[model samples]
Target chain A: MDPTEREVACFEAGIKFGTLYHQFAGTPVSPESAASLERAMEAAVENQPHCTAVDVAILVDELDTTHDYTELTGRYMEVHMRIDYGETVVRTEMRMEDGYPMMRVVDVHEE
Target chain B: MDPTEREVACFEAGIKFGTLYHQFAGTPVSPESAASLERAMEAAVENQPHCTAVDVAILVDELDTTHDYTELTGRYMEVHMRIDYGETVVRTEMRMEDGYPMMRVVDVHEE
Candidate 1:
């Protein structure tokens, strides 16, 4: 099936976030990195058949880079995702772990 | 100095294209893929100080995937890029070569 508008928008947002993250982190967002992020989003809602949108944003003000710069220091990010199948909304915080973006759910509201 | 609006837009476009390319190619746009594209863009106008924007578009109608799908078959793409420095505009055709996006100048006009 052709992807929905929301799906396309969500995917586009993912791309934007990937670029923004690399820009602030002083790293370049490579295609590999983007694929990793796409996999993460898929994993996030793997079981949800109706999941349509996934949005990720950086809390720029909350970003902290005080750790050793020589090593990869995972930073916090804000995520708001939507699952249309169940009218579900997921709000969470996430960070990179071992070079992978991981999320911790803060809220899941079902409408 | 802060990045120019055009720079940010170009970078964002790069991200979008990376995703779009993978979506169509059935492969994945990785961090490495994005980085390589960025490098190619840099190389395109490295000497130009006022270069600002780069845009990429897929020639969906021209896309011919009749070849072996298992292998990376580089496809042609349409590109319109701008360099504000010399008031330049770059219109070209590009494709993936050896797993990297490569461009060939079709037209370069300064206004």
Candidate 2:
């Protein structure tokens, strides 16, 4: 069976989430660099097709400040993305779930 | 609509590839850090469910020598990943396509 355009849209949404999570996870980040990193992440993913917007928040309060900076990880940030494909639109979010970062589809509907 | 096992496998493969690519893409890299980075990437993705093996190679020779270190990106590395979901197995690869990193499933089959 062939995948519907809806399924393709879902797959694309998953791709964006995976990309956002992986691409910046281990970067050296500190409270000072968090804002810049967040902006960079959003701009980087928005370059992808059908990605209408991206929002990234680095939890500065939770960052391990044992040193001047720490490696960025899911435990320290949250993300949201909006992807539109054909007439279908998908909204996804990522945050701590069971102490691990989980990305999931929040909503999907036809425009 | 529902996705088949193969599709789920493909989606899983995509996540690993995306994670592998994005998680490490912007790290400051010199020839010295490439090996450790590769190992960390493999270990990280391997922790994900259904991922069996991951191979990452950073092209040291391509480092932009104008500076002691450069940001990692698709132009600097190649990745291969193997994922198993139920009886379905998927192999994925990432390399430059049209001058951009492209993650694609190389094979999917049921054992």
Error of 2 at B89 (Å): 1.8
Model 1 has a DockQ score of 0.06
lDDT of 2 by residue, B1-111 (tens): 345566566556666776777666779999998899989989998999888999998889998868899999899888888888898877777788898877666666789
TM-score for each predicted model, relative to the true structure: 0.34, 0.68
Count backbone clashes in candidate 2: 4
Cα misplacement distance, residue B99 of candidate 1 (Å): 13
Where does model 2 exceed 4 Å of error?
A1-11, A23-44, A53-96, A105-111
Instruction: Please state the error at residue B49 of candidate 2 in Å.
Output: 2.2
Question: Best lDDT goes to which candidate?
Answer: 2
Best by TM-score: 2
Candidate 1 docking class: incorrect
Candidate 1 lDDT by residue in tens digits, A3-110: 765455344434433433442232222322333433333333322234354554433344333431111123544455544433445444456677677655555555
lDDT of each: 0.41, 0.81
